[model samples]
Every structure is written in structure tokens, then in C-alpha cells.
Target: MAESKPSAPRFAYKGSRLKPLRAFCQVARLGSVSRAAEALYLSQPAVTLQLQALERELGVRLFERSGRRLAPTREGQLLYDMARPLVEGLDGLATNFREQVRGLDAGELNVAAGSSTILYLLPGIVEAFRERHPDVRLTLHNVTGAGGLDLLRSDAVDLAVGSMLDVPADLGYTPVYRFEPMLITPPDHPLAQKRELELADLSPYGLILPPKRLTTYRLVDLVFQQNRVPYTVALEVGGWEVIKQYVAMGLGISIVTAICLTDADRQRLAARSLARWFPPRSYGVVMRKGKFLSAQARAFVELIQPERSAPRDAYASGPSER
Candidate 1:
């Protein structure tokens, strides 16, 4: 046989490609080789070599020096966005796999919800979840819609349970429950006495509403504006309880979702369907687009939507908003 060139070293291409990609992601995230090295528990030279090898393999200049710090180039940023999640997933693979195998025996689940959802909608589901998975540390974060989305995006909460009128491109919203819009006032208020109400009937009264930024406020405003019925907001408040209290005290009449209408609330306030004008609001799970649900999170979600039947509190109010 002709003289054969010495085969390349056996170990040259044997190692996993994940090492360099992991190093690249760390350096991109920290913006400094030394910091990335410390985070990865590797030497600075090793990190530098990894980055160099990654750039050489991809044939791209991954970073450019910005003063004393490193910043990713356009291609670098694109790569970073794609690689970051993968690296994180792989890094947590061991723990996630163990949790998957162990089921809900031991794990933690963090959920975000608005006040109304937490107080009314989640009570039964939460109780059931606790009963089933007591050992699986469960925490429900009380946050508004925007705050909940922020928590979900940052991985601070595994999922969010709330209403979303507008879903973002990078997130997923699956609405599993619906609640009618209701016009609420003190039982003896003029509007409450009418057998049948019209949208124009609400025009003369000042409304108690959440801030103009909230969905409820915007929806109410849109309906009145569309029908050319002029209305005023007497107070811009935050929570459903506070709004209901203000309305019951005759501060102003308000429009609310049935989700907050309980038996106790009905005795204090008269609630009539405003569903004729505004659409029913849908509430359910909100999660990051590509998030990985652990065993604990999956179990909690199952409780929210059981296969046998809806939870006791799924429909918070009775047949009528009366």
C-alpha cells in the first residue's frame, strides 16, 4: 500500500461540540472572558480558546471590543439568541430529567396571577393542587398582567394564570375559562332597578374603573366610544375588591368581569350582564413560547384543567350576574 499519512489524533474530534457553544454563550452573556471563565469554572485561556475555536468553525467574527467590554456582533447576537436557551436547557437537563422521573414527589412550581384570579378563580384549583402535591413547594406570585408577563419571560415564574386580551408573539396564551362582563352597582341604584338595561343607561353615571392602562378600562372605553355614549370615570383604582367596594358604597357604578362576582358580592351589589355591549373575558394559562414545564408545573396545570370535570370554582358566579 502507498505510504499513508499519519491519522489525525484520535481525540481531535471526539469531544462534544457543546463545550465551545457553552463557552461562547457564557462570554456573550457576561461580556467578559474572565467573568465567563469564573462562571463556568474554567480558566480564562480555556474560555478564550473555546470562543476562538467556535468563531473559526463558524467562520464568523462573534464579538467586537466595545471599550473594555466585549459585545456581540450582529451574527454573534443572532447566534447568542438561538444558543442561549439550548445551553440553558442542556445545563438543566440532569435535574429536569430527574424531576421527570421522580414526578411531583419533590420539586417547586411558581405561578403568577392577578388579584382577582388568585382570590376567586384559583381558590379551588389551588386547594386541590396543594392537596395532591403538598411536598412540591408551590408559590403563587400576585402580579398584574404586565408584571406577570415580565415574570414569565424572565423565567421567574414557570407559568401565569390570568386574562390576556392581546397575546404577544413570543408568548403563548391558552384561555380555558370565560367570564361575562357585568355592570355592578349598589342594589338600590337606578340602573339596578331596571328590568332591562341599555348601554345608554350607563352614560349618565360616573364609572369606577381600574386605571386607563388596564384591559377592563380600555374595553369599557371602547364600547362607549363605539356606541357614541359619553361616560366618565369617577375614580381610577387597581383591584376588583376595591372597585366593588367603591361601587357598593355608591362612589360610582362599575363594569366588572363575573370572575370577581361571588355570592357575598351579590348580596352587597347588584350585578347585571353588560355582555350585550362587551365581550366575555377569557382567562387561562400564559407561558413563554418555548418554556419547559417541569413535573410540578404540569401537575398544577392539570389541576386547573382536570379531565374528569371542571373544578368547583371554575364558574365563579351563578347563572345570573343578579
Candidate 2:
């Protein structure tokens, strides 16, 4: 009989492929090889090679180029969904395991929040956390709504603190603060002098609003549409501070969360409560469903919501207790 050819290995060791899997997941999360490379602290060529190796090993193209962005293909999405949790668990295992043993003495905590939350809400909480656990490394990622959710989904952030008008099915939000909506105008603006303000009163003056993609803009649009009030947008700005600056310069009035209206802002602009026209915005902590919290993250959450940090059994007894 002719000599039989040796068969190729049917499976490779899982340990050997972990590096490529991590590279693939990072690329998927960041949507670009270069960005992923920067995030992973690796060379772009190295990341590219790892991605190619992963694709070859799996016999599939994981990502597709879409308008200057690398979007995950269906197979890529599936692989990411399956591989992310495993990768995160393995990567975090050492730190979390040590934290569980050492009782929160050392660990890393990553949090995501928008400008408003970081500026108005987090100073005291961050101070308290630093005082309590100075050894723990804490990083605050300044991200907007969609970006915050993206970080939460990719396990980049332990939790996010922000306002959510709509909550996703796979996330849990715990409200920690509530702030009213306010309409702000320059001191000499016509609306500022009105004795009784109405939604229609805003129609004559131009408005400075955040980007249309933001929840604040959508809420403003919905409220105006519902009330049959017409408004004009003079400019679409990004940050509350920038919007305030424009408003103070007589460019346009703006609707802002009361959290952002400090005493300094009150001196330059006139702020009137719009509680009757708009709902109070709730700022909260958001986390992915079933995500395991590290000791350090749990401690921070407790500091943010001390009243809810009661004994576990107290919460387990009934919905009322919870």
C-alpha cells in the first residue's frame, strides 16, 4: 500500500489562539485596526497580522469596510458576542480574584460619564472613593450617551453615570439624582424679561441646541411638537459650556439641565424653570445585565447609592424591601 499522508491537526490549543481573539475583539469594539492597536498598546501592523491570522484560522472574513469604518460582519458579530465575555473573564480573573481575597484593597475601576455628570455630580463621589481606597486605580471616560452604552457593552467601563431617556433591555439603570430642565437666555433677551413664560414664547428667538443625535435635542423636539410650538435652531453645539457661551454672547437661547446651570452661569444668563413643559431628567448609574462587579466597583456603587447598599437579605426578602 502507498504511504498514507499524515493528517493535519483537527484542533489547536485554546491558549495559543487567545492573543488573536483578543485582537479581534478589540478591533470589533473600536471599529478600526489603528484605534484598536493604540488601545492594545500594539503596533498597527501587529494588530493587522493578528486579525489576518484569526480570519485564516477561522476561514471567515470577520469585518467589512463600510464608509471609512470597519463594521463587524454577521459572523464577526457572533464571534465577538461569544468571545467577549470569555476574554473579559479571563483578563479580569487575576485582579478580581485577588480583590476577592484581599477585600477591595487593590483593583482597577473604569467609569463612563458625560460632561454634565463629570462636572456636576462626580466630584464628591470621586473624592470619597479616592479617600477610601487610594490604592485602587480609577479612570473616568468622558463619553456621550451612545458611546457610554458602547463602552458598557464592550466591558470597557465597569459602569456609566448619566441620564438615560430610554433604557435598553439588556441594561439596568439606578437613578441617583434628578434635575429639572431649564430654559436659559441672555440677560437682555426678550424671553428673559417675560413675566409668564410659555413654550410658544420661545418661537420668536433662535435656539442653541446640542447635536440632534443627543437625547436632549430629541426631548426638546418632542415637547415642542406635542405643544404645537415652532422653534428655530440658530446653532447646534456639542457641550453645555459651549452652548452657554454662545447664549451669553447673544447668539441664541438654550435649554439645559439644571445640573449644568451653576451660580457662575446664573450671573451671565437668566435661567427659568421649565418643569411644567419638560420632565425632570434623571441621572443614574447604568450597567450591563448580569455583569459581575469587582470589589472596587461595588464599593464605588455603594458610595454613590448608600441607601440601596443594605444587606443582601433585605433586598431578597421582597419587592417592597427592594
Candidate 3:
């Protein structure tokens, strides 16, 4: 057997350079070494020395002094803008940890989620959250897959959870869960009597679904087109809960995911496997190309992470999707 070699020594990023980098960034943002020193609670000479070291390290003049006014050199502006967020983020993370220890942490994870996730998955996530991070506030916003991406681009939401119909050039996705679409029918419906239903089986009954604006419609349509099945849509409604309620009222045959039904919900309706071909609906994590998610947002994501057994049904919206 081969023996493992000792790991190489790693360098610390906070080594002698953090003070200089912090001072240089602050001076650039404030455009005055005196102001930067005051803000940092340091002597002006001390701040100036740190800035000098930063300038020496990069071999560039960071700022130009013009009698009572200081302006960043072109290079200084670039460096400061890039470093500002990094240093601020680190500081924020530290403060958050300290607050957690003192029972005074207050923060929200701005999350965009699909209606189904808001309905079914979030409750478990929120319930377990009290045990793990009691002080962190969780703010969830409802967004369609496409709409969620817009929030991410606009920096409205820190992270997005749902099915993305369009994977834009400036976006990314992670498959957190996978669910298969199934046929939903009233308990008394003829199709409800079947053990397994197929896409070809849908031709006999009218369809009930949300409007085309919803991504589920696209997945359903794609399945119909792929399998060359002839099916006419009967009702195009809004909201999955409304659709399910209508199905319970014997509106029409509907299609939904298995996760959407619990034992109680199942009593009101019948769920059958779609023997017909359809792509698996994957719930995903969507985010902007280069956005930094908040610490709470990241932790929530880890907790709600899909297991091997993906849920297939939904309920009414939670605090997330409005």
C-alpha cells in the first residue's frame, strides 16, 4: 500500500496584507486617507502606511492627492470596487456569527421559489430551521421559474428554487429534486379506476391545467408532442391548488406530480402513474451568473435539498409564492 505524503503548507490570506488592502479600499471609496483612518478607528499615519504597503505590493499608485482632495488612480478605482464587496462580505459573515452566539442575529434569506416548493417542501424546511438557526429570519418570495430568474438578475432574490423553462446565458441551475408527472382524477372518474395511466390514455378525458404561463404546461405539452398523443385541453386555470380543488369537484382529468398528494389529499383524488412517456420534472436551484448568495440562503438550500425520493404533489402557496 502507498503511504500518503504530508500535505504542503498553505498560506493565510489574512497575513500581513489584510490591513493594507482594507485601508487602500476604504481610502479609495472615501477619497480621503483621513476619513478612511477615522472610519477604521486608526491614526491617519497608520492608515497611510497600510496604503503605501498596498501600493508597493501592486507596484502602482493607488490615489492621487490634489490639495485637500484625494482621487483614486484608474487602477485604484478598479481594485477598490472589487475588494470592497469581498471585505464587506467577510465582515458581515463574522458579525452574523457573533450575533448568532448572543441570540441577536437578524437577517432574511431572500429566496424565490416555485408554487409547489412553496406549498410542500418549505414547511419541512421552515420547521427544521427553528432547531438549527432559530434567530435567522427566512423571507421567501414567490416566483415562476422564468420570473424567478428575473429576480435573480435584478438582485431581488438571493437564490431561486424551481423549474427553469429557460436556462439563460447568465444563469445556472442545480437539480435538487426530480418528480414524475401523473394523471390526477376525481375519485369517481373512470380513469381513477385504472392502476396505471399513460399519455395515450389522456385522449379520452378533457384536461385541466394552469395557463400556458406556467412551466408545468410546457412539460405536459412536450410530453404530448413527444409521444405523438392527441389530447385536447379542457380547462386552463391558475394555481395548482385551484386545479386540485376543481379536480376534487369532478371538473376534469388533470395531470400533476406525485409529491403533491399526501394520504389525506389522496383520499380526495386519485393519482396514477403516467404509463405514457413524459420527461421527469426536475426542481432546480436557479441563480444569477455571478451573484453571491447570503449565508442563510445557502443554509436553507442545504436543508431543503431534495432527497432520492422526490415529492410529486403540491398544495397552496406558502409565504414564498404570492
Candidate 4:
């Protein structure tokens, strides 16, 4: 009789199977290894090692590299299908354990958002969320509007807060707030002489603005186009705050979100609403579709309201002291 080759040992289908499968699934779902590593608190190589080991254990290639992404091969899809329940059951089991041990207060949440969010609105919401769930770990990362969207798509952030200027269709947006763009002008500027101004009225002054590609800029552009108004854009800055400073120093008058006006800003500068309705700009929460939110995030969700709940300038008085 020919000697039989050594066979790989079969696992009993419970514990070890879970962790690797869970990590592997997250890595695939997120389409990023570094993000998965951060989620699991493992080094990048450690996550890669788990994926490599998983493929070797199955005796079939589970992944094929396509550019920077690791996509499931035909065989990989089958394995993932087989592994889904096992991973889900483990997640449920963990949830149950935490509920029993920590009384439903334990969990983790991550948010990535624009820099203005850190200063403007996130502090109160985060504080309230933590007061209710002291056991949960909350983390926030500041990114620019464009960069924040990229981070959300990559699963680097579970939640994103920014201007909904021209969000992609793939995202699910909940309007947290809305505000009108105010004409930001120095106290003595002639544009400040008007109590309310129309788009066409800005022709006399140089203008500073966000890049035309920004959603706010796009909205401003649309307003001017709709009304057949002509105005000169002189300086293009990066953020609303920068535009405000240049305008305050009289470099140029800028159309800016009203929330940017702190008490000091309000003293040196004057703002006016458009004579005709300019499209209102909104800042909101953006999250991905089909991804399940954490419990803490779910609680935070309860606090966001549609644009109708509060107009943009309303909060410049300061957020409801909740």
C-alpha cells in the first residue's frame, strides 16, 4: 500500500475559527488592511498575517489583489459565506457578555470629521453621549471635508460630520444643522452699509471664497447664476475661517457661514443676509449605507435633527445648552 500523505488537522468549528474570520471579514468589508488593524488594535502586519494564515489554512486562495484593495476570489466568497454566521454569533456573544457584565454601557465608537466640527458642534454632542455611556470609548479624528469623506468610505471613520454641500449619493446624510451664508465684511466697508444685500450688490468690492469645487462655493455660484448677478472673486482660501480672517482684515469681503462669527469676529465685522433667498448651506452627519452602527453611535443619532429643526444662524447664539 502507498504511504498516505499527512493530512491537516480539522478544527472543531468554534473558537479559533471566530477571531480570524471576524478580522478577515472586517478587512474585506472595509477594503483596507490598515483600517482593520486599527479597529482590532493589531499592527498592520498582524492583520495581514491573519489573512495570510486564513488563506493557507483553507488550501485555496481567498483573495486577489486588485490595485490597493483585497477582494474576495470565487473561492474566497464561498469561504466568507460559510464563515458569516460564525462571526456574527461571536459578535452577538460578545454583546451579550458585555450587557451581562457591564449592563449595556460598554462599547466603542469612532468618528472622523472636519476640523470645524471639533470647534463648532461636536463637543456638546460628544459630551452628552459620554455622560450617558461612561463605559464606552469614544475617539475622534479631524479631517478636511474632502478628506473626511475618503476616511468614511475607507472605514477609517464610522461617522463623519461636515457640510453637505455636494455629498455623494452613496452616503446617508442626516442634517444636523443649516445656516445662511452671510456677507463677511469689515466694519467700515461700504458693503457693511447695507442692512441686507443682494448678490449683484457685491460688484464694488473684491471677494474671497472657498475653492469653486467646494459645495458651499457651488451653492454660492448657483445663487449668482440664477439671479444673473456678476461679482469678482479675488482670493480663494481653504476654509471658512481663513476666508473670514482675510475679510476681517479687509483683504476682501467674503461670503461665509454665519457660525464662523465669534463675539470678537462680530465686533470687527458685519454680516448681512441676501436680499433674495440664497441657497442655505447645511452641515450634517454622514454615514455609510449597509454598515451597522455601534450602540453609542445609535444613541448619538437620536440627537441629530434635520435642517428644519434649527436654522444655521440660530446656533451662532450658541448651541442649546443641553
Task: Show model 4 residue runs off by greater than 4 Å.
Answer: 1-107, 305-322
Q: Could you give candidate 2's per-residue lDDT for residues 1-322 as a string of tens digits? A: 9999977543243436777788889999989999999988999998888888778777889999998889999999999999999999899989868767565777789999887677766777898899989989999999987898999999999999877878999999998666677889999888889899889999988889988998889999999999999999989988888998999999989988776766677679988888899887777789999998888888888887533321132111111100
Per-residue lDDT, model 2, residue 253, is 92
Cα error, residue 308 of model 3, in Å, equals 11
Q: Give the alpha carbon lDDT tens digit for every residue of 110-206 in model 4.
A: 7886666666667667777778888888888877667778888888877887666555888888765656556778989987886656566787787
lDDT for model 1, on a 0 to 1 scale? 0.82
Q: Note the Cα lDDT for every prediction shown.
A: 0.82, 0.81, 0.72, 0.71
For each candidate, C-alpha RMSD in Å? 8.9, 15.1, 7.0, 13.1
Supply the TM-score for candidate 1: 0.69
lDDT for 42 (candidate 2): 90
Sort the candidates on TM-score, descending order.
3, 1, 2, 4
**Of candidates 3 and 1, the better by TM-score:** 3
Each candidate structure's TM-score, on Cα atoms with residue i matched to residue i, is 0.69, 0.65, 0.70, 0.64
Residue-by-residue lDDT tens digits, candidate 1, 113-133? 887778877878888888888
lDDT of 2: 0.81
Better of 3 and 4 by TM-score: 3
Best by TM-score: 3
Q: Which one wins by lDDT: 3 or 4?
A: 3
Candidate 4, which ten residues in sequence have the lowest lDDT sum?
313-322
